[model samples]
Target chain A: MKPPKTDSSDFILSVQNLNAWYHTTQVLQEISFDIQRHKVTALIGPSGCGKSTLIRCFNRMNDFIATFKLAGQILLEGQDLYDPAIDPVEVRLRVGMVFQKQNPFPKSIYENVAYGPRISGIRRRHQLDAIVEESLKRAALWDEVKDKLKANAYTLSGGQQQRLCIARTLAVEPEVLLLDEPCSALDPIATAKIEELILKLKDDYTVVIVTHNMQQAARVSDFTAFFYLGELVEFWATDKIFTVPKDPQTEAYITGKFG
Target chain B: MNSTRQIKMRLIRQKWGDQVFQTIAVIGVLIALTTLAALLIDALSDGLPRIDWKFLTSFPSRKPAKAGIFSALVGSLYLITLTALIAVPVGVAAAIYLEEYTSQNSRINRIIEVNIANLAGVPSIIYGLLGLEVFVRAMRLERSLLAGALTLALLILPIIIISAREAIRTVPNSIREAAYALGATRWQTIQDHVLPMAFPGILTGIILSVSRAIGETAPLIAIGALTYVAFLPDGLRSPFTALPIQIYNWVSRPQKGFHTNAAAGIVILLALTLLLNALAIFLRNHYQKKHS
Candidate 1:
């Protein structure tokens, strides 16, 4: 495999003229943007406006939908993600995703965290334990779960389950962590914890989050991309997007005029 | 004020309709259970008298008083074990393929799914004929226990596969997303997450389907399984006699004693079915409890 040549050292992901469709109906039309390294970029948009769809494109998660089709390039570290030579599985490895719903496997909390490492061929008990502990600590869940790592993941509360899911993703040590409305299902206190975890995670990983809550976007994101009607309405520094959005639609959405 | 009366009248009518539906649903369940209970009582009164150790241990004899279900019982146990060996993996695999690997958007996958559902509805005797043509005549597995097992496996396969698919389908998409997001291949995701979660449902199907297999007489007869075998099957190639076939033979005899023996045999069959069901339920509940 040839190494992808890069123009910008700061950008870890670059989307160019990316258009996606479900069969004949296009949902993402000519979307293009660059996400910088080690920064949290938030994708905010109204429901059914392609916030989830756009993030799914990063890990090629939409390929399971038989009718899903996309044209354009999603470059990860400068390599074309859609290239036949580049397996989607490998892309997913480098760019791990945490879904909006907290979906831990029916396995134990320990097993859940170790699942990725095990698949990647880490077998020693000590090594797995170390990884699980380190990952859970990073997600700020080690204290609650460490004593009963063998317990079923479902035994955890909703917030804890979401944190367990985050730990599970982190165990894989991905370069980019994608959260699709991670706190939408969580309560205010749990949301605060996750938001803090996301801020901490950006020190080591490039973070992409999709949130419906505008306050959340303002609080956590360094950069914000506002999408409307399957189009990128505005993208700017988070403070600027919240304070003085160039697009009137962006202004209306943030001001709670109409979503 | 007149419109408010009309609205109140409409609400009262809707509540009455809901009560009618609720009663109908309860009555439907009661009818099904009562019929099953009536049959069980009749069978018990007729058979429970003849269920001594001698009747269970003795082989089929020309004399009705001397006849027993020993060989048939052994043959059935053997057949069931072999059928499970062949059916469960194959059925579960086909289910996984349809549910996890292939999307229903493809014509062939949809066709296969539709056909499996149709096959579940097809008469067991038709599957026996299929086994006769394919395994017995073509493959030359002549009247052997393996041939009988293959036939029964085919008969119950659609049921197992359809239920397995339903079981697999109940595994939410979010679980799959978690595995896939961990960079798992499709096989890894299914093997690691999907199958385990779907197992309780699959086990329930297997228990119900295998019970159906045990009670089947026509299919085995159609496939040429022996009605009366004095000895246990020597191996997979040996001719076999199942409980249903043995019961059929006794029930057909003109002797009043043989009919009583037939009833006794039905008790053994019922007990065996319950045992099988209990074992399946035990395993299913055990796994479900541990996982949760």
Candidate 2:
């Protein structure tokens, strides 16, 4: 199979003037950015800065929150994702999410990967096996887990569990992957492995990550957006943003002058 | 030296207070256990001599000397099955809707929740009144097994719902998030992940409710359950008698032999409750082991 053509101009997702609220409190104020195809875009901020909320909006996970509401446009491949006609379920299928904590379903490793496909109407055993293998391999977990595909997911270590979550997301063949502080619950070594996997994953899927660690953003992302108090302070190439940002607040935040 | 001695005396007083409280707690627990043990022992001693195959399988007769609990036992079984079948689904569905689907901010939902909590605390006999009005008279299903089952179902619905909601609430938010992130729809996540995790808890609640329903005679009698059901009920429309009703009837009779028969029936009822409780415990332990 030939790889899909992805250039800088091929933006996979575009968000414009996205305002979000939690009950009466406005949590995200007119956040706007474009996610380029096959590139890693990291959203970095301090805690409670709406970094996670912004990413959750991409796939409409915030719909579950009773008080959560959003305004403005989120377009996937130039189509409005939040349009009334578009199903959040279908949007979630195309744009998969991995949470901060490693949350593998209470099932076997094989079943975890096969879950998405199974729900989406894939029933043939051989096809599901192939998808599971390919997804686990993509997440860099196939070799460690190959012999124990039938083992319970909880038996794996924290890092392995996070990777299993990734593999589970990948099994559905999503075009874009969202990671909400994927390494926040991991140790340094596990964080490094995930960072490495992120670099590799960008070659295939458009990756958007939320992280509190500035170094992680610098290490893995191509583009980085800095958020402060529900506002997007600045967004630019990762190297440029870290070295010489346009905004003074971004500079202070990145330099540890203030949050 | 004087100040130091005073401080020591104060410390001794505090220690004595702590000991008093601890002793009270221990005594309270022992008192409860003793009461329970006495009840069990008394029932066994009184009922053991009367417990025979003939006592179990034979029906009640005009003479207290020849009475048994066959009709009552069969009726209790039927009532329990029907009660479980009706109450479990309605209670679980209400609980899931309240916990997962409905918004907490809505007034109607809040009212429903409050009513359920109040219902759990209401006297069982009060429920009998409601049953008489709704199931027997309003529905016009008087003096039948259906009315009795419906009445029992209403009595236990609140308990099952409250317990089930608690169980569903204890499931971690992370599990739901994991399922949702995988593109599983709300129903799918509930069906595939949440419900399975909550199953053991729901089963436990159902077992407890069913046990309570089995021992209840007031509500059944209020709905006009017959005391002398000589033959087995062929359908839900037939009049029925349960174990508690039989015990009540026997105990009211003016004969020592009838009193002994009632004691025997009480022992059987207690045994049935203990067995159900044991099954609930086993299910909980099995679920914990499998999940952990």
Candidate 3:
């Protein structure tokens, strides 16, 4: 591994000389980048370009895969996340994630949001109620679901279900949010709503999103990281990357000439 | 025009094959249902007259007309209760360990999975012999109710584990990941989410296995459960007799009255089994409707 980079306080996450593989097949090689605090960073690439894999490494979700192997330093708040003394569970609690598909539990809407706080030892009913209400409000879903908190989560529409999942993750009060193509399954109206929520969320939490839509990256992200074939092709301010990308491959991809 | 004629002919041949297979399948179903109906009719015709309040309450006697299944019925009930108490927890725990705690690709878990599948197919008589040696002799329980229950527990443990594993496996991995993302420990995830979701399925498996254990006689007989139990089993230590053992004994006798009594016993056993199966189906449907 290369010498550790100086990770300043402005950066909430920093990856240095990272290499990752699933068993014998390498998926990412020599990836290094720093994610700024309270800013939205979009990792954009075509399918099979390892963008998703790199995002998953933010909170160690890939630890569940038995064949996955990694050799690198992932620092969260200037502390090595992979240190033996640190538990992966703690890392996950501090860094929440929302999946591409809406995965609300087969429970009440209230219970779905309260689940995270409950597992963290918050048992008082009023306290949970407050957290659930606040989280749902922050996710921009309270106006529609406040009256039906007792209803089963499956009763909600596809877009509402996805926002409920966001509320569920937010109840844990994480400092960072990782979203893996969070709106790929939704229609344009729902996508616009979620994009608005992401912009609002960056005021309080650092956001790292993996999306294939170049327009989405340009609209929501402050910084855009372009990945191609397991390598970081280019990373810069979203405005500069779209208008004056230094790499010819990055320009070719953004222009829709070839993916 | 020639190619179109050939296609028409191929369609006709396909329809003929389909009709033939449908006919064979219908025949197969008819054969199974008719055989079952014939046995029930025969048993009801012979035994319906003998089944009364007096017959149900009376104890066995030397005279076949005075014999009843009071002791055997009670003993069978007691035996199954004990067996379920011993087997359900152990079986469900073993299933959870195999499904959740161990990685699916581990060599040890693979060996265990194959062994459990093979065990489910093993003859019940082998479990009887095992119980005879382990519980009856080595543990010094003798041919008592405890020994019989332990033997039957062994007989159905494999079935329970296999079914429980299937039930637990039905809970999607997405749910587990959701729980883990919230910082829930492995056991906490299983207890709060996995077990509750799998409860209906696990209950169905337990009931089915218990019903099988109730009908078991080879293992009970192998462990030396008495055939002429005159009194109800007082406790786990008391010697007992089951309905199958009593039915077997009466069927062997030359007297016609004993044959009628055996038929009555078979009817009762069949009713009990059907009732348990109906309960299992009812519970599964109830939960399915609630969830879906």
Candidate 4:
């Protein structure tokens, strides 16, 4: 098999013939794709289709699972992510993630945002304060939480909490942000707000989002990949995939004929 | 119409069963409370007159009226404090390793977990024997406060580890994942997020175990804690007598006045346990409020 071009300026992440398994059960099969730099790429599939598993692989979040195993390679700007000398912690630093459910630390709002910086050994109060403000502002949550920065993070509304998690991720200054169905727990309004944030974030960070919602993929992503039964059935520009999908399964899924 | 009537009858029977369960539970609570109250009242009635400033300030004597628990009380305090200082850090670190670092499916970890649980159930007297053989004889610490403290520390280490593990497990995996996704190493994740979140629970466990250590008699006696220490322990190596040992010695005497002193010793020991429990509850609530 020919190696995928990594020197291309457009792509920031490349997955080549990746196969993933949880113990004996394979969840992703021979998946290959490139995430465009500074663009949102959405992974859309049904519940068991391995979309979330693929997103987790980008930042090595799946490393925590005892039975998780994978073959093939994931490259970040041509560097092998699974190389023995490269630490998972370093991978996560460059590629941050947000989970499906909102998970702000059980700390004050300001502390929640500053946690990443603190863990990275930043000690000066002034430095942390600036990072907190900037990250929260970028998440579009600064105005709502600024007055009550000391309030517990659990006090925030679901949407605001989700944004706080996003701000927490941004504080580490990652180059790529992988959001695993981040709006699944939110109401329509909250989902819309997060979708808006994702769009704004694409200008600065490469984004890979997994969503069950077809319209969300259409609205936020530049490219969309459709997975079916652990296989990539189609990958194309978001408009073309929705309008004229080459795979019948992809078309059927987007049209709500079946999961 | 017949089926509807049957349904109504079944609902009424179910409600009666619910009431019966509640009544049984209430009866259980009443029985426990009454026994505790009776014991407290009996101890206070017998010992209240003997408890005075002089009683607290004096030492044990052949004359029952002149005897006090001053040395024993101080020794008990020192023992529990030392036991906590030794047991807490060791227990919590062991718990963290078992919970966070090791795979639950591994054979060695499963064996270790089972042994720790078994250790919690092992009799305290057995711990006394171990302490006697190890700290007192082999280590040549003699019948000193340090030996007694080491014995009690071993006695409660299992309980502390069990509770600390439970506390650490309660810190949701989501919080851990959040910490890791920000590039935090495993230790960093534990130090910054996991430990702080589990702090309240760990503290409650530590205090509860320390209180148990304070009331322990068999282990200390088995390790040969002095039954009558007239002078205070000057340091860790000095001979010591805890309240329980002092009480045991007093109760065995034929003199009625000595029995009264025994009751007074029981009262003070009970008070210390209650105070420690109250502190545990307070700190648990305070930290829970702050963390959440």
How much of the real interface does each model capture, measured as fnat? 0.91, 0.73, 0.49, 0.96
Model 4 C-alpha lDDT per residue in residues B1-292, reported as the tens digit of each score: 5698899999999999999999999999999999999999999999887899898878999999998889999999898889999898899999999999998788999999999999999999999999999999999999998999889999899999999999999999999999999999999999989999999999999999999999899998899999988899999899999999999999999999999999988988898999999999999999999988
* Cα lDDT of model 3 by residue, B1-292, tens digit: 5699899999999999999999999999999999999999999988888898877777888899999999988888999999999999999999999999888899999899999989999999999999999999999999999999888888889999999999999998888878877777788889988888898999999999999999998998899999998899998899999999999999999999999999999998988899999999999888866664
Write candidate 2's Cα lDDT for A32-108 as tens digits.
77888899999998888999999999998998888898999999999999999999899999999999999998889
Per-candidate interface C-alpha RMSD? 0.7, 1.0, 1.3, 0.7
For candidate 1, the per-residue lDDT at A31 reads 88
Off by over 4 Å in 1: A1-9, B2-31
Considering summed lDDT, which 10 consecutive residues are worst modelled in model 4 chain B?
A: B48-57
Off by over 4 Å in 3: A1-9, B1-4
Quote each prediction's TM-score.
0.94, 0.96, 0.96, 0.97
- Quality class of the docking in candidate 3, CAPRI style: medium
Off by over 4 Å in 4: A1-9, B1-4
DockQ of each: 0.82, 0.71, 0.65, 0.90
Docking class of 2: medium
At residue A98, what lDDT does model 3 achieve?
91
lDDT, candidate 1, B1-292, per-residue tens: 5698899999999999999999999999999999989978888888889889988888899998899999999999999989988999999998998888887779999888789899999998998999999999999999999999999999899999999999999989998989999999999998888888898989999988898899999889998999879899999999999999999999999999999899989989999999989988998899889766
lDDT of 4 by residue, A97-202 (tens): 9999999999899999998899889999999999999999999999998999999999999999999999999999999999999999999999999999999999
lDDT of 2 at A82: 94
lDDT of predicted model 3: 0.90
Model 2: per-residue Cα lDDT at residue B255: 93
Cα error, residue B210 of model 2, in Å, equals 0.6
Q: In model 3, what are the clashing residue pairs, if there are any? A: none
Specify the poorest-scoring 10-residue window by lDDT in model 4 chain A: A1-10
